[model samples]
Target: MQKTEKPFVEVNNLYKVYDGFSSVLDNVSLEIARGEIACIFGPNGCGKTTLLKIIAGIDKDYQGKVLIGGKSPIEVRTGIVPQDYDMTLLPWRNTVDNITLPLEVNGYSRRVLREIVVEFLKKMGIKLPLLSPVYKLSGGQKQLTVIARTLINKPEFLVMDEPFASLDSSHFFQIADVLKRIWNLTEVSTVLVTHDLVTAVLLSDQIFLFSPKPGRIVHCEKISLPEPRSVSDPLFVETVNYLQGVFLMGGE
Candidate 1:
């Protein structure tokens, strides 16, 4: 972003250490412009999720400044979708009930909450057995249910940690499409952490590439390819290849 344009989410000079040993994230700094979709891609244990935890207010035992829309994450409206979305669902609660828990607690009449949830699901084209217990649903369905639950509150921003990690290649693309759909429709600023370079290339407006453990930003580049990206598209392939090189260099 330009000097005059302020970021909606900003992290500056972050440092994190676990068990008072070595650093997890060292001197990490990055920014996300409002409504931009940025991806943080790196190898496992590179402090990707650790960085997100700090930004989400889930882990404050760190040294850094994490600001969301000029306020700390605790002071702003944000939702997190972890990789273990299936585990996050209420096993005893049926699909609809689990997704609507937030609304239910807010005192929306049962009838009203049901109507609202149905409408939201319809918009997303997600059709699941309303009364089916979450454990009975398929993996993809569970992920969808988690996304629905997260969206029910209509967060201004979203932080996703390898949300598609559990899926196979086919499911990966399927969920990736679902994510892109919501992203374009809602225009919500999102920070997605993923290990898949292809997924990042296809989805990100820009990418914040990290080095190995004790992670730090090694490359932050704007993805100039147009959307509705296809694997066969030359620009898409070129961009992916370019990012592959970036990642390779970062690991060296």
Candidate 2:
């Protein structure tokens, strides 16, 4: 494989504390290469969400330098899909309106926004007719709508926090495939935070393993499974097993 350029996202000496009782993230550092799908995996309460929030600019009180394309996180034009759909998507708006809200807020012309929204709806497998009234849509549809919203802006960096946690296995893989296809199509750097090991193995080019509270990155493994990897492949199973071992044996 050809070596890529420097990381599009980098976190150095990151630390987060709440109530001064304990640090959620302690001197954690990571790098995500351009066009790579990087996954952050760890036990619950391991500060994975906190780290992603800081990177997404949702939480700014932490101590660290998060750089996106060599600029501060706030300086980079990026998109974020939060773990909670309710937090990221407006309940009152219909799917299309929700997806296009970002573009409208960013001052895109109506015609331009319409064009982008149409393409993203198609990409997300959301039909135009079903775009009305988020409450009318199924859970899976709502999640896809949020993804479409994130992609509609054509961000250089995309951050997803357990976006598939609520989906059934079938829906999860379908969404995962859609995400992979979109990443290939856009070549955008992505960071996905999930507790699901299988999902991480399926979607990531690199995996970052974190330890429990007072979290710190213990391992950074470059996934070498061949492209178009099938979950049934023996090599894929072997890779997953090895990753599980790495996670079980966390080190500083």
lDDT per residue (tens digit) for residues 70-173 in model 2:
98787777799888787777888877778888788778886677778887767656554445788777667778888888888888889999999888888787
Candidate No. with top lDDT = 1
Off by over 4 Å in 2: 1-4, 108-112, 123-129
lDDT of 2 at 204: 90
Best by TM-score: 1
> lDDT per prediction?
0.87, 0.84
TM-score of candidate 1 versus the correct structure, residues matched by position: 0.95
**Model 1, stretches more than 4 Å misplaced?**
none
TM-scores for candidates 1 onward, in order:
0.95, 0.93
Per-residue lDDT of model 1, residues 30-143, tens digit only: 989999999999989999999888887788788888899998888767778888976688888899999898776689888899889999989987778888999988888888
